[model samples]
Target: MKNDERPLIACPQCDLLMREIPLPSKGAACCCRCGATLYRNLPDSLNRSLAFSISSAILFIIVNSFPLLGINLQGNANAVTLLQAVQSLWDQGMHLVSSLTFITAIFVPALEMGLMLYLLVPIRIGLVPPGVSPIMRLLQIIKPWGMVEVFMLGILVSLVKLVQDFRIIPGVALWSFVGLTVMLAAVASSFNPRDIWAHLDKDNDGKID
Candidate 1:
């Protein structure tokens, strides 16, 4: 293998080996053998991630605002939102878990979304925003942390446990979470950072002529 050769990465899902092909600019490559996709192109993957992040953020607010489920135990009833669960953990002396939940579910996704919109919208107009490269790098770092589905899994598990103790009733927040998850998947599908940049570069060159 020469130093100039790109190394092949294996698919974690299927154990298929694949090489990275050079896209016109920087973009994701696909598995030659199994057609599985590899690598996300563009710092703007942050932007595509933002599409879901924004919706997830709004859903996060709603998930916190209202109770996720209600329970009836011997005619006594109680309801709790996702945030209430975190607060309960803190009240019960589980500070570390609460902090982790808050940061992963709330802070990281919000930061990723806000930074992406700040960068991409300006680039769409053909002006490189100040600190563009640094911001792009930041977007790449934050992209993986926007795990709304993981949070949803936690919610589902909580609901299952609550049902054993009381009559668990789902609320609007639950539905919102479902929608948020779908939207996040959609956002991921719509964004191909390499594709967007290739078009952007084409447009930029057109203007120079």
Candidate 2:
């Protein structure tokens, strides 16, 4: 298509109108006004996103399935899982904190990763499923709410304080949560909405190919 007829994308930072053009596989488009990232043209965005999101999901399961920490105090042994930790907080009357912890660390991340996989898996097979627009919007809205790394940091800090009093043994879930935090970050970086739209564009008009 001609330059003027090419798709125009406004800068998300400053609303400057610019034409969106084909980019190299490793190339990125930046908003000229504020230098914010517009989009990136990564090779095989679908496959990469699918792989990372799936791995993150698995790690997330491991995080909740096993014990987060094993502790011994005065000859008593105890272990806690992710949900148990939240429950402990709630039992201590920190209801709001516990609720926030459950929502951000578990529910939001799971929902985000689930939505990502829902989109990626089908698009990998060349099918853009119904409700793509709403799912995409939901992902955007909840992406900020999935603060796994923040929760991880809080966990580590609390563990440090507890170690002075109790014999704390790191559990399988602790390492798994660490990995999940990294993998979730990878999933977010690999997933680009523009790439999904490219698929929709191709399917919308077979003549474009």
Candidate 3:
């Protein structure tokens, strides 16, 4: 009932409520009921998250700039970049599919990585940037919208089917897209919002506000 009391944390998987306990540096706390990891106190989490964000941003640029796949059919060569694929769908009147593909494959992932860098880079230096809370909330909302891995699976299926009819050549952008997906996932796992909250609370002298 006191503001100074340790906060209560509910296990996300099981909804079991328990008081939060202090964790050692580079330690993890888990839910007792479901044995799911509740939070981690990873050493240098901010720096690691910043690194991942930067890596993902570079990979994202590569994914959009270069061709993803090349095909040769009857001596005719064609290549498709990520943007070209979306544009082709739109040109064929599949506007909805084109928009969805662009959002999930390009927009959401880029936004997530950008927000991560914006938040973590300042936090790493013991300074909280303006609109930190709102930006963090936006990041959470966009997190689930990033479906790069799912898009990669669809690409793999298309590649398999296309290979049967034409010469399929995977491009540099395709590999970069794979790397971007992995980097994004790593950044998500490494960056715990609770850690950010803790840092903010400390900077504000025991309260986020």
Candidate 4:
């Protein structure tokens, strides 16, 4: 098999087998028999998501700078940012959970956003992305780490627990975080891994071998 060669992937919607096409492009090659659109090209969607990702990255930085939650009791108020929350846990010697949360919630999202921007922007400008194959691999690794939805669920649970005892005020940073979570999922879904791999076959001669 050639490097860019992709076998047919069966569409669950119509049971029509579709061939994978090259990436950094848009729209789906529909099934001629059933007229079912097997897969839609999501590069455009990814562009929108990428824009939000950049904005969210900035907001995320600000969110970390300030407090995520504030607790008031006995005429004393205490607020803590997300990093502070993790650090507090670490200070309490819950090193494992702290490390996991730090990696998943902070590092992963940042890495995903950075990698996406690095590859996508160049491709958008009609340039073959640099280091195509390795970037493709990076995308594969980052895909699982884009767990914004899971993190959001955890945040909701934490919020529920906090609201029981204190008057919780949602900040701009919090809303941005929520938006960022939703956008992250959008970006992930918008990415078509096969398409990215197609771009890696630089010579455009069909056969990589």
lDDT of each: 0.61, 0.77, 0.75, 0.65
In model 2, which residue pairs have backbone atoms overlapping below 3 Å? none
Q: Taking the tens digit of each residue's C-alpha lDDT, what string does model 1 give over 92-177?
A: 67687667666765565457556766756666666656665577577667667546556655645654564353333467887876
Q: What tens-digit string does per-residue lDDT give for candidate 2 at 1-209?
A: 89999888998889999998888888999987799888888898788889999998898898889977564545677787768767766776768766876877777778888888888888888876778888888887876765656765575466447444323347678788888888877877787788788788878763221
Please provide the root mean square deviation of candidate 4 (C-alpha atoms, Å).
5.9
Residue 97 alpha-carbon offset, candidate 1, angstroms: 2.9
Ordered by TM-score, highest first, the candidates read 2, 3, 4, 1
> All candidates' TM-scores?
0.58, 0.85, 0.79, 0.66
3 versus 4: better lDDT goes to: 3
Q: Which regions of candidate 3 are displaced past 4 Å? A: 1-5, 13-16, 33-36, 71-76, 155-168, 206-209
Cα RMSD of all models vs. native, in order, equals 7.4, 3.6, 3.8, 5.9
TM-score between model 2 and native? 0.85
Clashing pairs in 4: 23-195
Cα lDDT of model 4 by residue, 111-206, tens digit: 877877787677656566657668778777766656765775575455446344333348866776677777777676666665554553543544
Provide the lDDT at 183 for model 2.
Answer: 88
Highest TM-score: give the candidate number: 2
